[model samples]
Structures are given as structure tokens and as C-alpha cells.
Target chain A: MVRLITHNLLACHVKGCTTNNFPLVFQDVQVELQVAEFNPDFIRNMLSRLEWTALVNAAKQVGDTSLPPEQPDMMDDELLQKLHHVLMEIHVTDGAMVCQNCNHIYPISNGIPNMLLAEHEIG
Target chain B: MIPTPDLSHLTRHDLEQVYDPAEDTFLLLDALEQEAEALRKERPLICLEVGSGSGCVSAFLGKIFGQSSSLYLCTDINKHATRCTLATGKQNKILLDPITCSLAGPLSSRLCHAVDVLLFNPPYVPTDTDEASSAQSSADIAGSWAGGIDGMEITNRLLQDVECLLSPRGRFYLVALKQNDVPSIQSRMLEDFGLTSQVVIERRAGREFLLIIRFARTAHSGSGSTS
Candidate 1:
């Protein structure tokens, strides 16, 4: 599945494009909701590592407006459920991730993202 | 007076004998095993064991999943503990990358790669009022247990840093004593952090208890938010 975590680590592999290659801009995304369990402690621990603004924007693009504009001091079940959905269930089954920096595009098919570079792009 | 079993004899093969299973190890192992099985569904995985003592359990897990290309990272807060644990894992034919560091220590980004499974059998015993009788002498002994006054000391801090290392769909398991204020912990997780939880195991013996907890990946719907 094209998970947000995988999405977070990906960057444009295009040649001569180094700076700001990450936080790939999602375009024409197809979101799929799959049920998963929740672990609050894990999520609490993960808060420090998340890109809140980017995740919220991406989720909004996919019609999921569950996250708060700001992170809450208290992690209530209600907020957790929303965070849970945004982080785990929303799968990008089909779409293209366009790089904000180099404008390089990576395609997603059958839920698997193609992160491979073209023959000439390989270093 | 009958001489207490020699620490050397008790700790012979591994640290497994350091604590009575009924009191500590069994509860933690129960929780670790429960989550380990679920994580195994994604075969050929890499598991991280935080606060791994003597590396016995990780070794056992490595053996079970080693045939399928799984590797275990057994870590501890002290260097000597890591050495001992690594030696045991190696002797038992378990693939392990042993790291010696504190729970709050920094890890290299390479070592912090997205992990499929995270297990913790942290020190969950509260300190006694009598400092003389407390097990807070050695760093290993102190790090091994002494969870503040309530037994959530190290564990509480450890949970906050796990997100950076967790892979998508990664599973987490924590084994804590029945007296460790589970409801408060759950509430803290559900309320303060955005995560869901399930009680996988609970052993009831009058006032005492042991809980096996499992958490979902960070992203998933049903935050039940009012906003």
C-alpha cells in the first residue's frame, strides 16, 4: 500500500535535484479507507516526528478533514480516532506524487509506488 | 539463614533468572510474544527490542523467524548489559544488532530505519520508600526497574520517541505489571496522543494484574473528534 509513512520518506529521484526534494506534492490521488487498530502510546510517541501541516493538507486533499489545525495537548479518544484514520487507513491506491522541487513525478499503481529512477536518472 | 541463590548462579545462562517470571518476565514476555505474532504476518521483518535484558527472548524470537530472514535489534541502557545480551543471542544463533544506550539517548538515523515491529519490556517496578532496600544501585539494575513511584517512569518517556522509528503498519507491544495504572496509561495514550489500543492479555490474581497492550499504526480514521 502507498502508506503515508512511505510517502514521508520519498523524494524526487530526478537528476540534479537535491534541495527540497521531499514532501512530495500529491496529485490526483485516489484514497482508500482500510480499518486498522490503534495504539495511543505509539501515536503519542510519533507526534514529534510528524509533519502536521503537510499531513493535514494531504488528508484534506483526499477529503479527510479530521485533524486539528494545531496538535492538542490532550490526546483524547476522539482526536486519536481521527488521527488513526488519517495516518493508517487512507491508502493512495492510485496516483502520482509530484516533487515540489524538481517537479519529478512518481507513479502509483495497484497501491505500489514506483520510486525507481529512469536509466539516465540513476547515479 | 538459607543463603539466597548466588547472583552468579541465578544469572547463569541469561538474565532470565534475575527476576521471578511470575513477578516480571512472564508478563513482559506475554506481551512481547502477542505482538510478535501479529508482526510476523509481514514476514522477513526487522524487529527492535527496547530494554532487552540478556537478549533471551529476542534470541527465541530470532530463532522462530530467522529461517525467513528476520533480524533482531536488542538494545539496553548500559554497555555491559548489551554485551551480555548480545553474547547470549549469538550463542543461541539469534541474529542481533546490539546497541548499548539509555532509553532517552539519540540513535543514528540509519539505526532508526522504519521498523516493522517494536517491543518493550521496560522497568515497570515502582521504587520503595526505603532507599536502602531499593534496587537503584547499578545503572543496569536501576534502568531495569524502578519506574519512578508508579512504574511508568522510563516507559512514559520511551513511548514518545517511538513514532520516528515506526514503519507504516508497524505494530507495538508493551508488557507492564497489573499495578502499573493501566487505565491511566490508556487514557493518556487515547487522550493525549492520537492512538488506539487493545488489551491482548490480562492475568488476574486478586489485586495483581498483567496487561498485554497492542497499538495500531499512527494513521487510521475514527479519532472520534468533536472538532
Candidate 2:
């Protein structure tokens, strides 16, 4: 659940903390790299859906800076391969995804991120 | 028919915490299989399942679309269920990412109108409001079927999000019982969200009359959700 693809989709959902929630700030993460079967089409398709800044910042938070600050205009194989690795292969087995806006912590343990909030925090 | 996902990896202890794949699960699988041809043609990229109990249905979806065509995302309140879902993906050679959270709660905003395929097999058993809320709070096996009021307390929450969740070409598949008032569900989705729907498949399993209803934006939008 710590895959960059999934991380990009997660935002702070705590009660009343709405604005500037996207791109949850990652902190104190233990990263694991597992090779996955790569599909260029999937990468290319996901490219459109990805929040480029969020992904780039998240990749760096987990200690990988290979991704460019901006999405490359060229969708070449070289770029696709890089996107595949950064998005699919990197796994954060332990740590927390802290919300920049609300400071809520979403923990990732044993490779699954617990995004469940407290009852009062659920909105 | 595509073979069901292998669940031999799931142990007895796992079932105690997670909802086991049973009649309702297979019914969702069967409905998905029935829609395989159209689903593939759409070439969907994002597939999300709410309350993915054993991860069986999403694994079957991987087999249908092939492993690399879509990103399979699942959400479950029960921690064991999410872990079981990840294991089932590994067992079946599919990549499934599971998040421990209530039904699509954490995913709603980022996935805004971006989900190509949405699924939910919510707790459809009518129970007391307190029972349902407690089950939801505890986030265990009981949460799988403790539907409050008209067996729709949970499903109703998701209904508010569906209109905004679906991509232009997106389709949502839901599992419900006849007691849930299937007709009213259809009418509300049409009247409120402008989403036209049709019952994809239905079966009477034991005393439960289960149905799979598929919904999408109206046909006049150039994308036909119905075959």
C-alpha cells in the first residue's frame, strides 16, 4: 500500500482539515524494492492520472530522487522504465504518512498503510 | 469461464478475521465474468474495490484484464482482510494493493472522477443501527454484513460518492439483496445522479436473493454502459 501509485491517491481525510491535503508528506519510512512485471501501457496510462508534483516529492521522501521535478514531455521507453520502478517497485514497509495540513499520521507497517482515522476524525 | 482466484494461501485463522468467499462473492465474480468482454474493450486503467474481503473478486479481475493493464486497489476496515487480499494477489500472480480504511474514505478526493471501475459488496444484512455502527467501529468480520436500517446504511454512504467517483467511461458494480429495494436504488441513482443502471445478474442463493447491479453515466453521453 506504500507504492508511489497508491501514495499519490491518498490525502489527509481527517475531519475539518480539508484544504492543502493532497501529497501527504512521508516521514521515517523503511523502503523495500521488489521487482514487479512492467507494463509500458499501464505506465503510460497512469501518467495521465498521476499528480506529477506529488509523485516526485513522495519519491524523494522515500529516498529516491530519480524522477524529474516535471513530467517529461517524452514518453520514451527510458522514461517509462524509470516511472515503472519509481511508481511500482518501491515499497515502504514501515513508517508514517503525515498530513502536511492537519499533522495526522497514517502508519505503514508490514507494507500496508493504515489510513483509518479515529472516530471523531472521520469526516 | 475464468477460474476463480486461488485462496489456498488463506489459513483458518485468516477466515476468523476476514469474510470468507461464499455465495455473494462468487455472484460478484460471475457478474464480472459475464461483463468481461465489454470490460476489456473499455481498456480500463484504474480498478478500485471497497470492502475487498478476501480479495477474490479483484484477483479475478486481474485475470480478466491481464496482470498489467490496470492498477488493482482495495480498501477494507478489517486489517486481516487487507493482509489476506495482498496474500491472495501474490498467490494468484496478480498485483493488488490494499489499504486499511473505511469504504473508500481516504481515496475519495484523489480518485475524483478517475476510477475506471468501482466495486462494492457491502454489508447487506439489515441490523440495528447500533449493531452496524459498532461493527464498523470494531472493523472485523461482523462489519462484513451488519447493514443498518434497510440494509443500506453503508451502501448509502458510498452512493453519495459514486456519481463523483466514476470516470466518464467508468462503471460501478454493486452487490445487494432484494430486500434492499433494488428498484428504488435504481431510481435514485437515475433521478439524483443521472446515472442509468441495469441489473447485470441475479441469483437466489439459499434464503438470500442476491443481485449484481451495474451503473454508469447515461448512454447519451457517447459511452454505453449497457450492452
Candidate 3:
């Protein structure tokens, strides 16, 4: 899942299952980038839903390869382009996304993340 | 460089049982093995062969890649295909160890989200009388080819389940016939999954060229239908 969308639905699957568990935050991410064409509209449309801090931090944890450390205060065309590439173009084909709080690992394979929980892990 | 396996001495029927290996297979195999070897020190390598006809490529691949201590899983919708791969492994003095040789469905939990590299050469030819005949004459009905009217019948099904088998740090190499509807697949991956993919290798075959696609991310959202 894109950090933009992974941020939306991920809640800690702990017993409480509270809203705060959301964004399950990234820790020690190892990022790999494969360049892709930029599509501005897609980024603009996705802006409202993104967890700004989470996206920025996850990008860093994965690797400081690209993307600014912080989201800009204003949405400039150039900045939006960066965000576009980060969200849509950069490839995260491989790597594990470990949740900060629950330590749940979501493995990304061939660029697809497996979010399914084990039978015992299911609430 | 890895040792090249001996691919000679098979009888005509034996070769017939072994599906035609695409020319691109060699090129992609070379490149993929290079990348895979680089990471051998870091992780136990896992490779999957999709639609592995006669499973020779997987056997060859397993022999080469597994030489330095990596795990190889050869899978095909057809059990016969995997058997063929296993047969070659037996003859080549490769994959003698139980842990190193395996054949199963793409959906098996063992493979779910656990592959390092996936090599696929699907039957993308539009369904025709020949394919139907092929399916009918097979000892096993399911393993034969039922690519639907367009020949992408199995391709779509494979794609959906493939994501689950990919390891977090894995890469996939998918081979499709030239006339196959690639745009449909790409759009599904890009728009629905929010992935960026590329045609990494191409081998021209008459009017149609076999394409090798590499998916860089999963689909975030989109319509998934078995139709």
C-alpha cells in the first residue's frame, strides 16, 4: 500500500483497536527507488488524505534517497511534483514495513504488500 | 559467472515435453541471476517459476542460483510442468535436497509473501482450437491451458494471487506473448495498486514479441474481477 493509503486504514490491531493506532507508523524502513513518470493531478488529489508527518518520516526511515525531510507549508508546483513521485512513482518493490507500536510487519513482495494477519493474530 | 547447465542429450519427445524456452528467458535469467547473486550474502534466496512449462528453465535457474546456497521453488498451474522441472533437477545432480526442491500452487501459504524473485512465462496466446486440443489431450485437464477465449484466462488469475507470494524484498519477471493485452495489465497495476512497472525485456517473435514486465509496487485500489 502507498504510504498515503497505508496511513489511512492501518490501526494497531491490538485488543483496544482504537483510532489512535492508525497510521501504524514506520520504523527503520529501507527504501529503494525506481524512477517513474510524474503525474501532477494524482498527487494533488491525494494530498488531503496523506498523513504529512508519517509520509515524511516513512520516506526517511526507508532511506533518505529522495523526498524532502518535511512537507512544505505551501503546495508549490515543484513540491507537489516531488510528492507525486514519492507517492506514486518511487518503487517500494521490496522491504518490510514494521509498525512502531505493535511491531507488526507488513512485507512488500514484488512491490505488493501482504497485510493479512495470521489466523491466531486475527481479532 | 555461474556454471551453465548442460541442456543437451534429451530425446525429441523429451524436448517436446519441455515447452519452447523463449529467447528472452536467457537474457532475463542472466540479468536476474546477477542481481540475485549480489544479495546472496544478505538473505536466503527464493525464486518462483510461473507457468514453468516442462520446468526446465526453473531447473536450470535453480541449478545456477542455488549453486551458492539458495532455495528455489518451481511452480506451475500444471503439476506435470513442475514434474518436468523436478526431473531435470534429478538428472543434473541439482536439487537433491528436499529443502531445495518444491512444486505447488501460487496460492500456497508457504509461498505467500515469501518469494525473492518470480519468473513467469504465461500462456498468453489467444484461445484457439489448438489450445483447446492441447487441453483435451492432456492427462490432467486443469494443468493443460484454459486461457479463456482471449488466452489471458490464466494470466489474470495468476496476477491476483501473485502479489501474496512476493517477499518484501522480492522482484518479479513476467513473460507474456506479444499480442497479449499488456495495457490492460499495466493499467490494472498502476491505477488500482498505485504501482510503477516497466517492460524490462523484449524478444521479437515474428509479429509478436514476448515482453518481460517488472512490477515495482502493489495495487492500492481497483476493480478485481474473475471475468
Candidate 4:
């Protein structure tokens, strides 16, 4: 299940495939929209942990341009609601998360992404 | 006391394929409550739960740690478990990142030595090795309880990786049955990973003697020690 919250922290870990591995590109993504309860406090608290730029880029890649390019200095209710939808409501049901650096393709089937690498890919 | 996550969203049909909260889950919750003070003091940033069948444990943990302080990453081999977990988190107002993967899977390498608090209430029932393997391959409710060969087959694999997954001050809580040989497990962790452990809580439910064991780096083991 690729949520922006999980995707935000994920990077390509293919053996020595290190630098520029972050923000695995979402390709042929099949999005599932499920409405989650909106909680301003939860979204406010999550802001600090998120990589603003990476999340924004990933959101755009998945065709969700709701978030701004820059993280707002002051979080307002409206922005927090948008953040909630982007982070919690949207689920990537099926697709492949391709690494920009290593070009390793992690496929997602039935809402589960296969992050297992070949034996040689293990470091 | 932390409340159990609202599982009202899960229908009977959903529970048929997913493992519903059982005595083992409650035991883990009780152990967490016992260590609530220390856990808050540790101020963990990342918490990962393996085989998070119903997300009950992790959602309870979210309440103890508060909503915003840490990232709750939960994994279960069963796809339905992952979906149920997500819904449980939402119903409880806890944002959990539920990944459908087999016991840490792709996140292991990236999370090396980064997990602050880890939890696992694995399949600990003794069953035939072939049955366990098949259940695991099927990734259904059977995978939740069909522990192969003394119920250590799934647990042993995670034990080997615990040292690499835990941070210097990280703590791991595991639910085990008496039949699983708890003494040997504690000794092995001590010798191989230098992780000291103590039984946090124990209860006898039906035929199962449920035990919650807490493990941490030897130097920080004092935090969980009753003495």
C-alpha cells in the first residue's frame, strides 16, 4: 500500500544504489480514493516529519497537485485538510515504484508493493 | 489507559480472512501500558510492528505516544490485514502507515538501526512446518496462527534481524508462548545480539501461557528492568 506518508520515507535500496535514490517515481499508478476523517491536529503534527519537497514532487507525479510547491510557514485549516486528503485519502492500489538512480522497478499488485530485491541486490 | 483502536469498520466477512484481536494482542497492550512511562521518556521517532494483523496494537501505541510524535509503520503478509489496519487507524484517529509485506521486507535495509520501538505478536502456535509454510504462502488468517516447528520458525527469522533494526536506545517487545522456549530465546539474544531482555508480563489464557518480553541493548536494558 503506497500512501504518500510511506512513500515520503522510502528510498531505493538496491545494494550500492545510493545517491539520488529517494522519492521512487510512481509509474502507471492506479489510485484508489478512500475518504478518511479529517483531523487538523494530526496533519499539523505530521508536517515536521515530512520532506516537503519530496512529498510535493511525489504528489505531482501521482497527479495530485493539491499541495503547493513550498510548505506553508503557517499551517491553516484549509491546507491541513488538503494535506490530509493527499496523505491519507489517496492510496496507490497498483503500479510500479521505479528508482530514479538505479532504475529498479518495485511492482505493486493488489495494493501491496513488492520491495524484495534479488539475492545479489541485498547488501 | 490507551484505548483499543475502533475495529467497528471491520465486518464479519473481513474478520474471516484477517486475525481479529485476541488474548495475545491484549497482552501486548498490557505490557505497553506497563512500560508507558519509559516509552514516553525514550521519545521514539519510529515504531514498527511486524504481523500487525488488526492494527489494534499499533493504534493503541499511537495513543500512548500521542498522534504526532512518531511514525507507526506496520507490516502484515495478509493484504486484508493491511487494509483493516489502515481502517482501524483511521477509525481511531491514528495515522498508521500500513504496508503489505512479509515482516519488514523492503524497509529493512533503509531502516537499519533506525527503529526506536519495535513490536511483534507473531504466529506462535506450534504447527507442522509444512502447514506453516503453506499458510505463510497463502497469506490469510491461517498465517496468523500457524507457527511452524515450536512456533519459532517465523520468530527466529525476525530475531536474527532485530539487532540491525533497533537503534542504540531502541526497545523491542515480543509476544511468545511458554511452549516457544522463552529462556533459550533470552539467552540467544544476549549472546548473539548483546540484547538483554526481561519478561514484562505473563498470563495464562486457555492452553496458552502468553508472555510479553522486552528486549533492548544491554546498556539500556535497565529501563525495562523491574529491579
Index of the highest-DockQ prediction: 2
Q: lDDT score, residue B189, model 2?
A: 97
Give lDDT per model, in order.
Answer: 0.60, 0.92, 0.53, 0.85
- lDDT: the better of candidates 1 and 2: 2
What local lDDT score does residue B62 receive in model 3, on the 0 to 100 scale? 64
DockQ of every candidate structure: 0.02, 0.83, 0.02, 0.27
lDDT of 1 by residue, B39-75 (tens): 5566525577877766666666665565225446666
**Candidate 1 displacement at residue A114 in angstroms:** 39
Per-residue lDDT of candidate 3, residues A1-123 (tens digit): 233323332344533343444455554344556454454554564455356766776555555435565666677788877775566444454566565556777665443344544435544
**Global Cα lDDT for candidate 3:** 0.53
Model 4 lDDT, residue B156, Cα: 94
Predicted candidate 1 versus true structure: per-residue lDDT over A1-123, tens digit per residue: 455644544456566776776677888888887675565554555555566777777777778788888777898888877876777667787888888887877776555454545445643
lDDT per residue (tens digit) for residues B1-227 in model 2:
79999999999999999999999999999999999999999999999999998999999999999887899999999999999999999899998999999988888998998899999999999999999999999999999999999999999999999988998889999999999999999999999999999999999999999999999998776365441
The alpha-carbon deviation from the true structure for residue B172 of candidate 3, after best TM-score superposition, in angstroms, is 1.3
The deviation in Å at residue A42 for candidate 2 is 1.4
Q: Is candidate 2 or candidate 4 better by TM-score?
A: 2
Worst 10 residues of 4 chain B by lDDT: B218-227
Query: Which candidate number has the best TM-score?
Result: 2
Docking class of 2: high
- Pick the winner on TM-score between candidates 3 and 4: 4
All candidates' TM-scores? 0.53, 0.97, 0.52, 0.79
Model 4 whole-model lDDT (C-alpha atoms): 0.85
Best candidate according to lDDT? 2
TM-score of 1: 0.53
